[model samples]
Structure formats: C-alpha cells, structure tokens
Target: MGGSGFLGGELVRRSVMDGRVVAATYLSRPGAAAGADWLPLDVRDRTAVAALIGEFGPDIVVNAAFRQSDWVTTAMGAAHVAVATSENGGRLVHVSSDAVFSGKAVTYTENCVPDPITPYGAAKAAAETAVQAIDPTAVIARTSLIVGDGGSPHEDLVRSLATGGRNGVLFTDDVRCPVHVRDLSAALLELANSDRAGIHHVAGADAVSRYELGCLIARRDGFDPARLPFGRRADTDLPGPVDVRLDCGLTQRHLRTRLRGAREFVK
Candidate 1:
C-alpha cells in the first residue's frame, strides 16, 4: 500500500488478512498499525519513493499517497508512483473520486468523460490521467464520499455537524453515494487480485443527500434531527457539481466485494 490513510489503512489490514506481503508507508504515524512493515517516506521525494518501490518489489502497486495542500502534490504524486512502477512491470491500482465528473446533472458511469471543477477533483482527475497514460491496466477506482468507523470524510463532516454551535448545519439537496471504507478496501483488494482492468465505478448501493445523512447520524447518536443545521448543496462555496452519483454497474458485475450505502454506518 502506498499510504495508510483512511482507506489505505483498511486496505493494508485486508491485504495482510489475505496473506499478502504488505509494505505500508505513512507521513507521520508510520507505526500506527502492526500488520505491515511501516516505512516512513514522504511521497514528495521521488528518489525515496523510487527506492522504496525498488526495495519492496511489490507485484502490484497501489498509488494511494495523497495530499490536499497543493495541486502538484495531489496530482503529480500519482505520476511519481506510476514512474516508480513503470520499470517494475507492476499493475498500478489508483484510487480516484466521483469529483472527477462535473456533477452536472449526470450519473457518471465507467465510460463518462472526466470533467472536474474543484482543485481536489482536478488533482484526482489528473492522477487518473497519469495512471491511464502510464499503464492502461491500472485500476482506477472512482468512488464518492467515503464513510466508516475511523478517520474519513464522513467522520470530519459529522464532527463539524455535531459541534456546529446551536444550528448544526447540513445540506438536504446535494447527493452522493458513500461507500464504506471496509467495502472499498475489499473491492480494491479483489480488483488487485483479479485480471479486471480499466476504470470501474465502485460505489454504494444507493445515493443520499448530505442532509439526510446528517439527519441519520444525528438521530442515531441522540441528536435532534430538527436541531441539526440544514441547508442546500449550493450553500457551500464548493464549485459546480451538486450531485455526482456514480454508476457502479460494472463493479457490481465484476468485483467480489459488496459495496453498500452510507446508512450502513449510522448505528
């Protein structure tokens, strides 16, 4: 695994559970988990990245090291991983996002053209482009807002809602298909172990709005659903794309993991 973040950390555990020799990396907490040989290396340093890949000699490389600071770090980081894996002849499994789509009244499928608007989306789109350019066999797993037990987008959003003064804001308009971290991790592992190639839409069973999600979380955790702050997708400064619902038909047909909806974690 190239990273040990939310999804990457779970992927590492699953990879080890599947009896695979995992070499995990992290920026700060290298020893966060005990399943893999934690290697402390920064993705920004191409030489160190190359050295790690050359040393580990993994049969398959997962480019999951991501940063939200600059576009170069977010976009070009995937390119560096692709470069490191180029000489090794290993298949690169790159994780992408639904943000790659413009979210302009279209339910994006595996075949949809990428048209990202946000810097994060654009970076992921760029990373996807880099991987496709370097290795056609690389699995670009495009997904939506991820949620699970530990650190993830949902957790952050939940904390924000739970402690947002008195209002506890939420948007009832914007929609997304949030896949659980466990399911996404399993799907990634299955894809890496299979011969399935090209871009695949691995997402939740159904789509729901952020407001509805917040409502569920609030209700589940003893917070009044009515007391929670509610708003529309347009309320936020996040540019274009209110709802980028993913088309997971291909993944549902191919992969072994069962990717469920966001409500699975509400309890």
Candidate 2:
C-alpha cells in the first residue's frame, strides 16, 4: 500500500499488521494518524519510492496512488510503480478507473477492452496496458466512483444543500456501478492474497444513475428529501464509448469474499 487515500488508507490499515508491514506514504496528509507510519514522499520520484520498497520488503505492492488524478501523470506513476514492484520481486495490484470505459453501454465486464473517452480514462487504460505488458502477473482492479464517508463529494453535496448552496443539483444522466471505498479495498486485498492477477471489475451491486445515486445518498443520510429533486444531466461530448457500467461477476466468483451491494456500500 503506497497511498493513504480514502480507499487506499482502509486497505493499508487492514492488510498491514504484525505479519505485514504497510509502507504507507503521503506527500502531505495535513495530519497523519497516530498508528500509521505515513511518510512524505512522491511516487514520481523513483529513488524515494525505490528506497521505501527496499525498506518495507513487502510481499505485495498495491499502486493505489494516482498522479495528479489525470492521464499523463497517472500513467507514468503506474508505469514507474509497476517497474519498481516487478523488479523488486513483489506482486503488484494497480487501482484503475471506470472512466476508461467509453460509457457506450450500461455495463462492462472484465472482457471489455478499455476504449477511454476522457483524459483520466485514457491514463488509467494506458496504465493498465503498461502494467500488464511489464508484468502479466500484476492485478488491475478497475473501479468506478468510490463513495464513502470522510468528506467525499457525495457528502459535500448534502452539506451544501443543508446550508442552501443551491435548490437543485445537476447530476449526470450517466450510469455507473459506484463502489464503496471500504468494501472495494477489502475486495482488492482478497484478490491480492489469492494471487489471482488479471483484469477484474470491482464495482457496486447496482447499475445506477448519478441522479439516483445522489438521491440514495441523501435519503440514507437523512438529507432534506424535498430539496433534493431530480435534476438534469450534462450531455458530455467525447470521441469514444460512454456509460459502460461494470459487471463484477468474475470478481464475485473468484475472490473469497462477496463484495457488498450498492445499498450496502451506501450505508
């Protein structure tokens, strides 16, 4: 585990213990947790990352760090980590994004090759390809909008509505299989321990829309029901497939644990 991001943080906390020493690092966490040995280092800096690799001696490495959370930066970061992890004799699990899908269909399986429609999606798709090329044993866990507690955008919207920032919110008509960060973290670790390295769709239980998901979050958190009304979605223009919801059947059957459903994740 390299990043202490929302999902990444949970993964490290669970996976690292007496038998496992988590090499958790962060550039600037503002404040580090008491138990975590959070380091100040950048993954793009090969030497620093390599030094951490040598010190931790981890059996498995999960590249949950996304560079600038965009295309070029993310791809390069993933490529660098894959190289370091493979050369260091550690298994690699790279977190990928569903933006890689063209969003042309309702759902995508592990079978769907990525046809990225956005810069972020392109980076992730490229990163997946590069990681696979270097080490076919590396696992690529492709996930969508990771929703959870701890000040996420989903939660922010509720806050905004509470303070009356806006009367109606504009949600995308786009459909996605949003996974809860915590459950997804568990699923990835299960895949890692199993040594089952390949492409897998790590998504939530339902194929839902942005509007539906927003309403669900609001309802679950007990936000004002009347103020959160159905809003319109922006028509995004791009050059590839769109709205490809992921089908995680392969993940369901392969891993030891059954991933939580969309509703379960929301809760």
Candidate 3:
C-alpha cells in the first residue's frame, strides 16, 4: 500500500519493472508511476481494508501506509491490514521503523523489543505488535531513515537549508542509519518472495548524525556543505531518540540486495 510516498513510489516502480501485476493504494491522489492499478484506500477503515484485500486477493501484500502523528492510521490501521491480509491468505510484508527503540542501547538487533519514547515510536511499536500477533508468518521489516537521490524528506530539507529556502539546524547529536530507498524497496520485495518471517532489521551500514547526513547530501547536490547549519539535539527538548541504529547483520546475510549506507549513496 501507500504507493505515492517516496519509499512506496519506489516499491511501485520496481514492482512494475519486474513485470508483476501491481495494485498500489493511495490516500490523497494517485502516484505518477504508471502501469499499476491505483486504488484509494484508508487503512483506518477496517471494512474497507478487508473488502479491498479480499477483492484483490494478492499473493503478497506490502503494508507501507502510515501517518506518524495519527495513532489510528499507524497502529490500528496496521491491525486492520494484518487481519485483512490474514483472511485473504496472502503473504504480508509490513514496513516498520527504528523509532520503536528508545536509543538507550544505541544499536539494536532484530530480537530487540521496542522501547519507544515518543508517540510516533509507540505507534510504530504497536503496529509491529499487531502485525506479529495477527500474522505470525508475516515479514515485519524495521528500517531506519530512508534517503533517496533527491526525493526523500531529509534530502529536501538539506536542499532547502543550503539554498536559504528554509530555516533549520541539522542536529549533530541525532544519529541514525539511513538506507537508500531503492535498496530498501528491493530488500523488502526479496523478503516478500522468500519464506523469511518475523522481525527483520534492514538498515544502512554506516551510522551518522543528521548534520553529517545533511553535509553529505549538500556535497552530492552541488551545494556548499558549509552553508548547512548544524546544532545538537541534546540542546532541545525534542521528544525522540537521539541515537538509534538498527543492526541488519543477521537479515543482510539472506538478502542478495545490498543495503547501501547514506555515506556511499549520497556520495
């Protein structure tokens, strides 16, 4: 689902490239990508979710639809998708987030239990729980910050800050392992086709702060890295994790697609 967002758009594009019969879901409007059945869906509606999934009866369903601030969309919406997918007898690949961690451990493995500190994190954690409970055989892939060539939100923020289009400071203390959207989408599709079930950590290899990431992006996009303002997340009362990294070692062993780090991709 959610074939209009950055990561979701990539998934739709790749799936279409692979010559699969794709049916992508969108909320506001249809995505620009062609050759797919773009269906409007609000995952919050349980009846609608069930009806759509049942009608489609896809062999595999990837649940990537979520709203960070909305609990019903992120948490309850996931439960509804899980139930529908389960009833339809389809393999599910639910996209999760690293926000589930509290950053107390700095790094987390696939086995790490979620200890969310923010509302968004808690919602993602709850979504993971609901997906797991409803479909034990489902692949719940927990990824980190998703960076793309020039499409992702982080990349946009870097460009805006560097070009004086926006005012913001990249936090040097806020660290994460950012994975390329293409790599992440390929990995998710690979897992969806495979028998790998349960929680999997799919993230980049390098760990870097937001400021460092912005600098890398700035350099790649022909902007002066020096123009990107920086600060420390610790100085602010931001209710989120400071340094959360997902260890994708175990999950990486089984995948042919390499999860390129932000440092490499942005270069």
Best by lDDT: 3
lDDT of 3 by residue, 1-267 (tens): 888989899999999999999999999999989899999999999999999999999999999999988999999999999999999899999999999999999999999989999999999999999999999999999999999889999999999999999998999999999999999999999999999999999999999999999999999999999999999989998789999999999999999999888888888
- Order of candidates by lDDT, top first? 3, 1, 2
Q: Which stretches of candidate 3 lie over 4 Å from their true place?
A: none
What lDDT would each prediction earn against the true structure? 0.79, 0.74, 0.95
Whichever of 1 and 3 has more lDDT, that candidate is 3
For model 1, how does the per-residue alpha-carbon lDDT over 165-241 read when each residue is reduced to its tens digit? 44445667788998888888888878987998889898897788888877776776677667666777686785657
RMSD of each: 2.0, 2.6, 0.6
| Worst ten in a row by lDDT for model 2 | 233-242
State the weakest 10-residue window (summed lDDT) of model 1: 160-169
Shift in Å, residue 259, candidate 1: 1.2
lDDT of model 1 at residue 249? Answer: 86
Taking all chains together, each candidate's TM-score versus the true structure is 0.92, 0.88, 0.99
Q: In terms of lDDT, which candidate is stronger, 1 or 2?
A: 1
Residue pairs with backbone overlap in model 1: 168-229, 169-229, 170-229, 170-231
